[model samples]
Target: MATSIFFFVLLFTTVLSRTTPDEASRTKTLDITSSIQKILNPFSVKTFNSFKQEENTVSSSSLLSFQLHSRVAVRGTSHKDYNSLTLARLQRDSTRVKSLQTKVDLVVQGIGKSDLKPMESEFQAEKIEGPIISGTSQGSGEYFSRIGVGHPPSQVYMVLDTGSDVNWIQCAPCADCYQQADPIFEPAASSSYSPLNCNTQQCKSLDVSECRNNTCLYEVSYGDGSYTVGDFVTESITFGGSSSVEKVAIGCGHNNEGLFVGAAGLLGLGGGKLSFPSQINATSFSYCLVDRDSDSTSTLEFNGKTSPDAVTAPLVRNSKLDTFYYLDLTGISVAGNAISVSPLAFKVSDNGDGGVIVDSGTAVTRLQTDVYNTLRDEFVKGTRHLTSTNGVALFDTCYNLKSMKSVEVPTVSFRFSNGKELPLPAKNYLIPVDSSGTFCFAFAPTSSSLSIIGNVQQQGTRVSFDLANSLIGFSPNKC
Candidate 1:
C-alpha cells in the first residue's frame, strides 16, 4: 500500500493577546457613536440619527457575507452535459479524497508527538501570471468567495477555508507567485496598508515569523508543498456592500505558489484568533454549500442568523489543534442499520489526537481504516445485486450504473454525540466515476486516527458554527 499524503495545513501557534468574548459581550450593540461622527463630521444629533438609519439599511445582518460558487467552471470550460459534469466531479472528488487522507495524517501528527514533514517534491513549478482564482479545475477541490480589500477597496476572490487559520493574499512585486484570476493586490496603492514590526504583538502570534530588515515576515507551508511567504500587514477589509472592518491583520504574500488557480488568496475561517471572524469579533458564522448541480451560488455568512429548526451539536475543543473545529461523531447507520464500531474510535484523545472534523476544503468524507472497512463491508453486503466494478483511484468500492436508470443505494446517516442524526441521500455517497456509467462509494479509509466530514456530504445543508455558544448546528436541505 502506498503511504497516504495528508492535505490539511496545520498552522503553528502564535500567542493571541485578544481573548474570546463572552455571551453578554456578543449581544452588545455596536458602538455607533464613533462611527457616526466619522461618517458625518460637524453634524447634529438628528443628522447622526438619520445617517444611522441609512447605515442599518446598507449593512447586512451578518458582519460579513459571501456567495460561494463552484470553482470548476471558473477555471475551465463547462462540461457538455450533466453526465459529463458528474463524471468530472467524481474524478475530482477521488483526488480530493486522497488529499483528505493526507490532511488527516497531518492533523494526527500535530496532535501527537510525531515529527511530520511535507511530502517531498509534491508540487512542480508552473509559471503563470495575473491573479488567478483560488482552486484548480482539474482536482484540488475548493469553494471561493469575493470580497473587497484595501482603502479604495479592490475586489478579490478568495478561497473560503475553515481548516486553516491565516488570511493571506498575493501582493504585487511577487518574487515567486502562482497565476491569479485577478490583478495582484497592490498594497502600496492602498494608503491604509501598514507593515507590522517584528516585535508587534500580532507578529509574535504567527506560527512562522521572522524579522527581515526590521519588518515582521511570515511564512506558511501546506501539506501539498504549496506555500505563502511574505510580510505581515494591517489593512481595511470590506464585506457585503457597506460593512467594512479597518486595520485587519492579513498576510501580504510576495511569494505565494500553490494549487490556487481561480482565487487571489485564502479567507481563513478557522477557530484561531487571527482568523477573519475572530478578528472582527463575530459572534457566529454559518455556510450552506449548494449542490454541485445547482447553478446558483451558496452563502457564507459571518455573525449570521441561524435557522431555529437546525439541530444542535456540541463543538468539541481540543487545545492541541485549536485551529480545527472538532465534532463528536458517535457512529454511522446504513439504511437504519447501525454499524458496529468502537465508540472510542470517534472520541478525541486527551492530547487532542483522534476526533471527527467538519472540513470545507476536503471533497469527500473519510473515516479511520478499521471503521471504514467495517462500513464498506456492510455496504457491500447490503447492495450485493449492484454490479461492482474495478475501483477508482483511492476509492475501493465502485459499481456499474449502466443497467439502472437511477441508483438505489442505501441511505446513510451520521450519528452525532448529541443524538442528532444527519441522514445522507444516495447521491451524497454514490459518486459517478465516468461517462461510461461507473459510480463509486464516496467515503474512504484513512491511515491516521482522525476522521473528516467533507463538503460533498455537507452539500445542501446549513452548517452554523456558534463560537459564542460552543455549538455547531445543522439543517438538512436548507440551501
Candidate 2:
C-alpha cells in the first residue's frame, strides 16, 4: 500500500511539472481534446453524399471557379465502410507516392542528359506515351472538380492533377472503361467537338502519336499499366455559364482503365503548355483547401482571388521536369527549433535529380529519409508527455488519446529559401487516423530524391500559383 501511494505521488508530480505556468507558456502547444467522432468524421464514407452543390456564385466571366472535393469528401461507387476505406485510401496513397518517385526518376534520367526532352530511344522499349507527366496512373489523385464539357456542356466530375499536362475525358464508344458516376461523354452530341487532323501542330506536340485515317490518335500509358487511347480533339470547355474556352485541346478517350472509376476523367493543372491552366491563358490560379474533416467545399480559381498579404516564394523551374511546380524548401522546425538535416536534402540538384515540389495530388508530405527522421524524432521528444501508441499505416509516430479530453502538442512550421515561414495548424499535422482516438504524425520519409509537400500540409492555407511572376504564395488560415 505504501509503495503504490508513493508511485502515484511521483507520477502526479511529473505530470504537474510539465504543465506548470512557465513551462506551458514557453512551449508552442496544440489542444486536441475534441470528440473522437469529430476526428473520425472524414473517414466515414457516408458522411459525404452525392449532392451537387453550385460552386460558382457569380459569372465565370469574372473568374473561372469550380468546387474542389477531396477523394473521401465525394460520394462514389465504393461500398467500403470507414475502417476498410481508410486503410484502402492509405494503401493507395503509398502507391501514388511510389509512382510519383518512379516518374521523377524517369524524368531526371531521360532529360538530365539533354535539355527538356525525354530519352525517346530508351522509352521506345517501354512503349511509354504522352509527355514527361506520362509516368503512371493509380487513380490516386486526391481532389475532384465538376466541370462542363463540349458545346452544350455536360457536367462531369474530373480528377484535378497539378502534376499532369493533358486534359482528358472518357468519351462514348469506350472500348474499355471503369465504372463512373456520370454518363460517358459523346462527341457526336456536341456541335463544337472537332477532331484534330494528323498534320496539326497540336498533334505533333504529343510525345508519341499515331495517324489513323488522317486523324490524330494519342495514347497515354501509366506506370501501373493503366492507359487511355483515343483521338485528340478540340472542344468548347466551359467553366461556368458565362465563360468558356473555345478549341481547347482534349483527349477523347475511347478506351480507359485504372483506379479512376469514380470520376469521368482528369483535368491537368500542371505548368506545361498543354495543361488546362496554360491552354486557357490564365496568368495565375489559387485554391484554399478546407480541413479534411470539414463539410465545406473550396473553389479553384483562375486569375481570380488571392490574399493581398500572402507570403511569396520564388517558383523554381526544373528544365528536366517543367510540368511540376518546384519550391525551394530550405528547412523545417518543430516548436520553433530547426531540425538537424542538411539543407541539401531539400535542394534541387543542378542535374535536376533532386527537388522539392508542391503537389496538389499527393496527400501526405514526403521528405528525404534523413530529414523526416530528424523531424519525427524532434516531434516525439516535444510530445513526450503524451501517451504513445503503435504506428498506423505510413505514419510511424502515433498517440493514444482515448482517455484524455484534450492534450497539448508541439507546433510545426516549414521554411522556404525566400525566408518565408509557413506555420501549420495543429489539425493539419496531428491527424486522426482511426475512431479509437489515435492520432498519427502525417509526415513520412522517402528514399527517392524527390520530395513533395502534399495537400495535408496545405490545408486551410490559400495557395496561389503566379505563373506570370514565377512565384507561389501562402496565405495562412484563409480557407
lDDT of 1 by residue, 47-69 (tens): 11111111111225465776666
Query: Residue by residue across 307-415, what tens digits does model 2's lDDT show?
Result: 6888888899987777889987888888777788786887788777788988887778999898899999999998999999998778899998777767777778888
In candidate 2 the C-alpha lDDT for residue 340 amounts to: 84
TM-scores for all candidates: the values are: 0.78, 0.86
Model 2's lDDT to the true fold? 0.75
Single out the weakest 10-residue window by summed lDDT for candidate 2. Answer: 116-125
Reference-based lDDT, each prediction: 0.69, 0.75
lDDT of 1: 0.69
* Residue 250 local lDDT, model 2: 88
The residue-level lDDT of candidate 1 at 102 comes to 53
